[model samples]
Target: MTSIALITGASGGIGRGLARQLSAQGLRVAAVGRDVDRLADVEATLRIVADTTTPEGAALALETCVRELGAAPTQLAHCVGTTLIAPLHRTRPDVYRELIRVNLDSAVYMLQAWLAALKGAPGSAVFASSVVARIGVANHEAIAAAKGGVEALVRSAAATYAAQGVRINAVAPGMTETPMTAGLLNLPAVREGAGRQYPLGGVQTADQVADVLNWLLGDGASRLTGQIIAVDGGFTTVRPLVK
Candidate 1:
């Protein structure tokens, strides 16, 4: 029997990478995203289109997946997020609200909507957090706050669902190379500065992050829960300037 995995925000970036990796691992993937066209191209067994930022949208997405897939997902990965970079003083309240809704609220809604199916399947659930959850960065007020909430939620979900055999964890990545960061990487100075700042001398790729996520959802990480793994290319542990 093939294990089923449901991934939110599967249209692009880390989410899309994870969907591809999971499918390659022989897990049937249910790719969910707001872009139907992009989701359709994911090469998964099923595609679901939903905003995921609202309770109703999440519920409908979960319902559609369960009804169409013929089995509860054995793994759930919430990879949908939004970033609003601005100094605290300059950040608007609406920006904060939207970031929270996208990063934190979506995770909560997706987990809650599929909690039953996940528990029934004895699954593992992973959330995409950021290194900002533990470290501070300039112009990261909104996203940091939202991801911090995600970290806390991961711990709570792990604890609350342990008895039900559902494992919950998070992956916190640092400056990754994706379409979202393509513009920054295009600037030679910015790219060089970012590269020099990491002990590994460069940013991570979406495939690297996706690899960790795949491990967490697979049987290899069956004993892990409530853990926050940092796939940061040593950025979290190194202080190049200090060295």
Candidate 2:
């Protein structure tokens, strides 16, 4: 049987890149997102229009993929997330709720549906996390909290399904050059400052991060599980010398 790969948030930078790469590898890909027009540009076997933030939508996406692909996805990449920058003091309740829904809740629901569809078959899943979840970043309380929940969920879910031969992992990228971070990077000063903050001296790109994620979802990472790989240009682990 042909392996099927499902990617959420396929309309976004990371998601679109993953879709193209997976499709290139000949896997029957299902690209899931809310925007039909944007999803049209992604090269996948099936483009599923659904809101992954909701349980119903997540289930529908999986169901549709199964109907089209004739089997449950053997690989899952959840790229849905929000890049909200706000300290708790200035963060509104609604914004926090939306952050949680998009960054955390969406993964929860999507994983629930994905696992259910897989039954007892072995599968691999990757979630998109961030540097804020590992360290303290100012003005990122809302996004950090939400992604922190995602990390927790990845570990717990990995533990829960490990014995069943299901692998779950996450990749936490630092200041990637995606549409989600365009607002911050568009400012030359902010972009330069952000690049300097990374020990490697530059921000990462969506395709760069997607490369790590694609490995985690393939046989090459068969022994890996419950791990959060940081693709942050050493930002999360190193401290460069001051000039």
Candidate 3:
């Protein structure tokens, strides 16, 4: 059977990549995002314009997707997130709130709506996390805390839905070059320094992370659930040799 996938944040980097890749794999893709213009460019079976950060918006997104596709989506790729770089003290309450809304709240709302749409049918969901959620990273307090919540949500939701054959997982990436990171990566010195922090000595691209997300949603990952797969170029695990 051909898989139907609903992808939130489908106008942006990783989400767009997933839409293209999944479409190539013959899945009927429903691309959802806030920007109609950008989402129009995404290759998918249906393009939905919705915020997806609020419960109403998430529900509308799923409803519209199903209405257009003629069936509920069995696969989901939630690529909605933000990259906030700031120390706890330096981070404003508004900034922290936005981070939570974009990263954590969006994931929660989307997953809830996705699960409801599935209605006991087996499905798979892959959302984005951050390497900072796994380890302490300076000047990343806000994003880390929000994504930590995301990591926790994935595990809890996975366990709750496992008996029904529903799978949930996340990919934690480090220093990927996307529009969200454009400000930080535009500077030569900053970009180089960011790259060096990874033992593999380069940042990930949106497509690279999208590949992993795609695999986790496929039957190849039938046994994988509630796992936070790190695609951070060994940034979280490897200790480089001291020169």
Candidate 4:
């Protein structure tokens, strides 16, 4: 039987890249997202349009995967997240709450809803974490906090599910070229400054991150779990020059 992968937020950006990559690797892809039209464009073996931001939506998405794909997914990729980049004091309560719900709660709900399936099938769950989860950045209070929770969630789930033949891991990316980073890249100075900060002197691509994720979900990374792999083009390890 062909392996199956359920990728949340699969309508765009990194999520879409992962969907395409996994599908190309002969895995059945269940593309999940709130945007039905966009999700339909993913060209996957299956498509599930459910807003992962809500509990009901998450359940429905998993149900679709089980019904159409013939089993629980052999790989789960939780890529549903949002960011509100603003200083703590300037950030509104609603923004923080929404960020937490989208970035942290969605992953929790998806995992809970699919845990039995995952255990029965024995697969990998990969969360798309951010480098900001580890490093502090200006005007990123809400997003950073939510992503930190994601890192904690990955480690906790990995430990909890290891005995069940499941592996949980996260990929922390930095300055990737995606629609999410378009605004920052639009500004010439911001783009150049961001690039210079990376030791590789360039930004990472969504495809590069997708490649790592594909490997993690495959047997090549069978022994890996509870690890946060950085795909930041050396940004996480390099220190900025202080002049």
How much lDDT does each candidate structure score? 0.88, 0.93, 0.92, 0.87
Q: How accurate is candidate 3 locally (lDDT)?
A: 0.92
Off by over 4 Å in 3: none
Of candidates 3 and 2, the better by TM-score: 2
Clashes of 3: 0
Model 2 misplaced regions, further than 4 Å: none
The candidate scoring highest on TM-score is 2
Question: Cα deviation in Å at residue 137, candidate 3?
Answer: 0.3
- Model 4: residue 54 alpha-carbon error in angstroms: 1.7
lDDT of each residue in 1-243, candidate 1, tens digit only: 788899998986898899888888888899999988877778699999898999999988888888998878878989998776678999888878888999999999999988955646578999999988778888888899899999999999899889888899999998888878888889999998888877778877898999999999988999999999999877777776665
Question: Best lDDT goes to which candidate?
Answer: 2
1-243 in candidate 2: lDDT tens per residue?
Answer: 879999999989999899989999989999999999999989999999999999999999999999988999989999999887767999989989999999999999999999999989999999999999999999998899999999999999999999999999999999899888898899999999999999888888899999999999999999999999999888878898898
Candidate 4 lDDT over residue span 1-243, tens digit each = 998899998976889999989888888999998877887678699888898888899899888888987888878999888777789999989889999999999989988877866646588989988888878888888899898999999999889889888999999988888888899888999989888888777778888998898889889999999999988877778866655
Q: Using TM-score, rank the candidates from best to worst.
A: 2, 3, 1, 4
Model 4 stretches with alpha carbons more than 4 Å out: 240-243
Ranking by lDDT: 2, 3, 1, 4
lDDT of 3 by residue, 113-170 (tens): 9999999999999999999999999999899989999999999999999999999999
